[model samples]
Target: MASVSVSFPKYMSHIPTRHAGHLAELCIVPRNLSLMKQGSVRELRIVRSSNQTEPLIDCTNKPSDIPLLSCSEATERLKQNREKHKGKQQFLAMYSSIYGGTVTDAAAMAIPMDDHMVHRGHGVFDTAATMNGYLYELEQHFDRIIRSASMAKIVLPFDRETIRRILLQTVSASKCIKGSLRYWISAGPGDFQLSPSGCNQPALYAIVIEDQSLFDSKGIKVVTSSIPIKPPQFATTKSVNYPPNVLSKMEAEEKGAYAAIWLDEDGFVAEGPNMNVAFVTKEKELLMPNFDKILSGCTAKRFLTLAEGLMTAGKLHGIRVDNVSVEEGKRADEMMLIGSGILVRPVVQ
Candidate 1:
């Protein structure tokens, strides 16, 4: 276990950046989201909440991740996206303002991003989602974030409760209706050294947003990746070392695909550069890598849970829940992309 520290970044210079013209696009559109598994190209759509019949809002002042609406309108917004528009949907990034500016009781300040991440990509973070407004299984994401902090030796200033509260509150305060949420924490700022202690200006935030509309209906289209996912030592760390995955996803996009799935040095199905891979058999079963090379996913674990439930329910004998050969994966009746954002994304290779 690693002890966490709280404070400023080591090398946060006063270098400024041109105001991002796509700030709105950056927050709402998945146009430039982190890498995700296969999907066709399509225009993204936004669904605003409908608080009509009953109000879902809580008069109480406590902050929430998914905003409470009047029970009526909440019911309406949560109803469903009217089916009409059609296009190939691709990106999935939607981060909300956890604090300050808008969309929350307590808006957050515009804290500066560190040069280390901007220049060297030397930061760490974690992502998780909310189920019915609650951050589904938070302990796992929190543990992973702590692990990321430990690996990079970046200390966090707040206690687990503080962080947990912020995450939950952010989710509960949102009016996302139904969808996913993404959260991250940085080592702040630091020097150019590989060590993490130099990160002085740490920032923590949680955002609530919906996923691409098409994914809910038709499955995603993916390609076997040319680039492979790295092992835990280099690839496992959840640092802002995102350029590699970002570039790979970009490459995939250029080819009209969704993500770059990585093969380990041993040449096995490791995982997508971002999400975990689950190979479901024709017999109604699923499998994920057990080498710990891939990020242990919440839904991945649920796949195992579902399998066991099915077994208990006599759905099947059992599922081969561990990693298997890429040949085996290719033969899977169906492949799934599992993660906080995707929930369970079907993959059509």
Candidate 2:
């Protein structure tokens, strides 16, 4: 029979002064042996109390020793572990200013794990594309995110001007002329509770991701989404709760389609998973679904504004925003999905 002994740091054996009479329990098991194996197992349990002497349990087996790691050694081990996945790090650069702190290393950008947004999905986000060092629709997207944050009850960590500068600085730091800048504003870190009352403040994080896919005007195909459309409240806000959107996109890919279009409960065509859908009728009239129960897309709005020129040039007869039935969309002369990521992709089916 093997003997076993258990030990702990002297500091852990002492009870906190605040909890003078409380008891502490510690259990130690052999690291090298499988607990499930058919062997008589013995564990050392330590009990500490202010008024009682520490008690130790002796077992048949000799104690298996465990080495404690130093802080530097632990940090090196973490770095080595992260280096193993260096190839999978996709962001070109990132910038974060949590709790009004200045921006730090892009490579080490991170949000607090305990942030309310991380666990409760109480956050809003937005993305804008950078073209030739210019952030397309940056102000528009920023405004939208601000509105979304208000709807989510998240206070801004910084004012509008400061946030704008941070975004621009992050993009410049990335040094990518053509990429996308995505950012989030989250309710700050605190106790892991259901309510935001425990949060200390709010946080803002931004990252620049390389998207080299060139614009392709070629028509693609899409199917109506099997995923249900979000209600009007959630649909209008660009929050981080995107499980439905992700599932819808996955559904499209599984069906061998470019994207999926969502329809409202009433069966009116709403929008694509991450874009706005537009249709051109045989009469050369452009029709887009109303934004009442869908995200008001910046790129889609820009496209509509630009398409007005086509109307003036007689390239299109008219433009209208109203409810679009699925049958009407299916029979339109042309259909398109418009968004910042894709610009404008015509739909063949």
lDDT of 1 by residue, 1-349 (tens): 1111222233422323342323332223333452222432222222233322222222333445687688667445533332233233311232222233224322221334443544566556676654454556678777877888778665665678977776666666565445555666665555666555576555565566554443363477666677546557767677777666777788788888777677777777787768888776767665677747766666677667767877788765557757568898888787877765566778885
Which segments of model 2 are wrong by more than 4 Å? 1-90, 99-107
Q: Predicted candidate 1: what Cα RMSD to the true structure?
A: 19.4
Identify the candidate with maximal TM-score.
Answer: 2
Candidate 1 positional error at 181, Å: 4.0
Candidate 1 stretches greater than 4 Å from native: 1-109, 172-180, 190-201, 210-215, 282-285
List clashing residue pairs in candidate 2: 2-60, 2-61, 3-60, 3-61, 3-62, 4-61
Candidate 1 accuracy as TM-score: 0.62
Give lDDT tens digits, candidate 2, residues 187-209.
88887999999998888988887
